[model samples]
Target chain A: MKYGIVVFPSKTLQDLANSYRKRYDPHYALIPPHLTLQEAFETDIDADKLTNIISEIAKKYEPFQLEVHKVSSFQPINNTIYFKVKMNDVLQNLHEDFQQQLPCEESKHPFVPHVTIAQKLSNDEHSDVYGSLRMLGVEHSEVVDRFHLVYQLENGSWTVYETFRLGKD
Target chain B: MKYGIVVFPSKTLQDLANSYRKRYDPHYALIPPHLTLQEAFETDIDADKLTNIISEIAKKYEPFQLEVHKVSSFQPINNTIYFKVKMNDVLQNLHEDFQQQLPCEESKHPFVPHVTIAQKLSNDEHSDVYGSLRMLGVEHSEVVDRFHLVYQLENGSWTVYETFRLGKD
Candidate 1:
């Protein structure tokens, strides 16, 4: 089965991300707005065993603050527009932990935690949206206490198979 | 350090358990009413590694129903009066998983998942309370989705070090 790990932002953040995604993101309907923890990957491993490993990973860390400070875009590399989440040690450790432990390939991209609001745009449209969004900016922050292991359905929409809560009991 | 794994029942159940515990359970104040998954055991293992292992375990299963249906006592076995929790494959599997994975001594007693309402009673007192409570017959059920890794504090109260949510993602 194909699976991925992600942290869905708060509803407020999701609504804001969706506001931009409705017009700009083609993938808006395919998956909820989220910060990709581990990119989607193929795995033939036993579902029970995979769930066990992820559960253990979730128990070690406390909830951490996530800050989305500004609108940003991967203009030069790609036309991906995103809410740039500020990096911190806790978030970095979580990403690395998932990378090191999960039975998946290393991500081709560097660990940049983001909520992509727009992607796959032509240069002119990218510039138009990115320019205005950057000017408007954005500032949202919330405590992230849980993450999900999601699977793609036959229909191509992603559905959560499990949710792991973070921190001490 | 010494650690244990347990599931704290809902407040409705806890409140019910505490009612009997106030009069019968000597260890009532030391910890909240809980179903012990793994008994307290000393460990020299690195905390982070232990946490990682536990997180993996938590992800493997979904929330399961717990039905506490009657007051029972371990007579001739030690006079441990408890709210007998009916056994199910999910709960049994959870207990066995912890036993097989965690660095702890093998339990001397067979696994009988329960919430102790009272313990350490005299032969006569145990029979008296057990008889009355059995006649009263408590019934409560809830879906338990998470468990805790807890440690004992210097004050003798147990506190949660981490909480692991069960199921995928």
Candidate 2:
């Protein structure tokens, strides 16, 4: 199975992202609004082992605030738009810690904590959306209490395999 | 054994880092100046297995240019100074691919590709050096042809276990 790890945004943020995503993204219905921590990799790791690894790391991190700062694009490189995450030591540490626990390959992309908005657009479509999203550089903060481990089903949609809570709360 | 993956800077860059590192860092004499891709992790995997994994991944990447742009610090979090890497898709992809191949735990810090100038400084010392380094930023670019897998000896110093070249070059 192919698996990835992510922290879904809060309800309010999810609703906000959903609005923009539904209009702009083709995969909006395929997955919820999320900031990917680790890109997907092929793994046969059992659920129990996955649960234990995530659970152990979860205990070390208390729920923290995540601020979505602005919209950015991978322009000239790829046709993807994302929400720029405010880089914080706590968040960086959380990513690093979880990465250590998982029994799969780590992503090579420099960890840019972001919720991808739209991808696979025509060049014209990307330019159009990029302009529209510039006005969407709003600041939204949320208390991140949990992260999910998800896997791609045969239908090409992703489903949550497990949820790891932050801290003891 | 404990292992790490890194790309050693070119000869000229190595000398440049070595000069600054020797004066500021205590570990300069202990290890060469190199950019770490993976921090040391304990593993029982044999060298042949490690080589095979790395070799397979290397074939997917063609040699690319890497630019070491400026100086940055982990101050207020940790006492370390590094050359801020210019984030690019190729380098990011390389890191993500190599990470997936290794059998070990990942680090708890976001991967910032840098040549360390100094570490283990007191807070005040870190402040002084950070100020000095801001004006000392120098841009250097080099073609990245290969990366090395190294292991720490019983004496706490690291040695190369294997070298994996990118593409056929």
Q: CA lDDT, every prediction?
A: 0.81, 0.74
- DockQ values, each candidate: 0.02, 0.01
Chain B alone vs. reference chain B, TM-score for every model: 0.96, 0.93
True contacts kept of 1: 0.00
What is candidate 1's TM-score against the reference? Answer: 0.52
Query: Alpha carbon lDDT of residue B25, candidate 2?
Result: 86
Regions of candidate 1 where Cα sits further than 4 Å from its true position: A1-169
**Model 2 interface CAPRI class:** incorrect
Model 2: colliding residue pairs: A105-B100, A107-B96, A108-B92, A108-B95, A108-B96
| Model 2: lDDT of residue A84 | 84
Question: lDDT by residue for model 1 over B99-126, one digit each (tens)?
Answer: 8998999999999999999999998998
lDDT of 2 at A60: 83
Predicted candidate 2 versus true structure: per-residue lDDT over A117-148, tens digit per residue: 88888999999998889775768988777777
Q: Would candidate 1 be rated incorrect, acceptable, medium or high by CAPRI criteria?
A: incorrect
